[model samples]
Target: MSALSPSAQRVQAVLDGFGLGHRVVEHEGSTRTSEEAAASVGCDVAQIAKSLIFRGKDSGRPILVIASGVNRVDEKAVGRLIGEKIERADPEFVRASTGYAIGGVPPVGHAVPPLVLIDADLMALPMLWAAAGTPNAVFRLTPEELSRLTGGRIEAVRKG
Candidate 1:
């Protein structure tokens, strides 16, 4: 296999550091979107862990929400949970905060530690596929492993 991209390697290193045995795989096609990642990984859309970053309007902090691909985040509800309103982070903010570009933000290994929240729906899945620091790179892990890796509060982040 070819070497993983530098960004992917960073994610792999973080996985290794955490003693998680998950393997990062780079696909020939794009895994940049939820549907694309699901097809690439041969998983249901709901099994894709989509990482979204929001900017806290008050603190200017980054808020990471790892939501299931099939779900839409209720931003207002999340803002309430975090005690502040949040706005969609722009590309520059995303890169500056997470050290990864949009469509490839991982649930872990952020340059600036973000307040994270995991979608409660994802906890029901047996396995999940997540972006691994690049648009074409991904990794799989059990819901339990995800919880361990992120330490993100599991909440009802999905739109009701």
Candidate 2:
């Protein structure tokens, strides 16, 4: 009903550049959390792809863990993969690095692109719903498509 937000527009441009221009969908209210997004789209939580940000203690850079909605990332495993200790990213750092708020960052199109690790569990689903920039905007893609788009490594990041 309303115009697309600036964040959504940026994401759209990025998606278009990647030839994934047909997937963006805008909805009302805040789909800030995976649970909220799943509820908004009337899908199982596992179908929501959550783009989580982490701070790399060793590299002093950002890291993104594209986790399944129903799973939590195991930082230890991720740190092992990246040769660094990992911590949850702060809101300021998240915004500065991703050009998005903590709840609205997409898997791609970041201000400071980070190393991405996708949850292997997400690959089990045929399709996934990911944040498209704003809290209420989303896009659909296959897990493989997500991997290719972000150049992310597929890993078992889900908590054990």
Candidate 3:
């Protein structure tokens, strides 16, 4: 096994800071998409926690939505819950907010803490996989741990 990339190391540090025993696993190929991540990690796509960043149109704050891989986020519902409409965050904004790029955003360790929301559907899964700060890195965790790590409210973030 080789060393973890700097980005992956940062995520590992955050996990350690939280006293979580999860390990960040680095892959040789892309885990950039939910399908790829599931193939690489050998898990159901629905068990992949895909982190999405949105920009609050009014507040100019970052919003983190960790949705199940198979679910599409209902932006309007999220807007209603947060009291502000949200727009898709660009790569620059995503990097600035999360200290990582679009495909590598993790559930924790953001440069600026966003209003974190975990999809309620994800909580039904016994185990989950999430990005670990690099397109090729990931971590395995429980849904309970995910909620604890991000202090994210569980919501019906999925679209109908």
Per residue, candidate 2 scores C-alpha lDDT tens digits across 26-141 of 88877888999998888889999999999999677999999999998899999998889999888999999999987889999999989999999999999899998888989889
Clashes of 1: 0
Q: Return the TM-score for each candidate structure.
A: 0.99, 0.96, 0.99
Model 2 ranges off by over 4 Å: none
Q: Give the Å shift of residue 70 in candidate 3.
A: 0.4
In model 3, the Cα lDDT at residue 71 comes to 95
lDDT of 3 by residue, 1-160 (tens): 7889999999999999988798999998999999999999999999999999999998889999999999999999999989999999999999999999989999999999999999999999999999999998999999999999999999999999
Give Cα distance to truth, residue 137, candidate 2, Å: 1.1
Candidate lDDT values, in order: 0.96, 0.90, 0.96
Model 1, residue 105: what's the lDDT?
A: 96
- Model 3 misplacement above 4 A: none
- Model 1: how far residue 35 lies from native, Å: 0.4
Query: What is the Cα-based lDDT of residue 125 in candidate 1?
Result: 97
User: Which run of 10 residues does model 3 get worst, by summed lDDT?
Assistant: 14-23
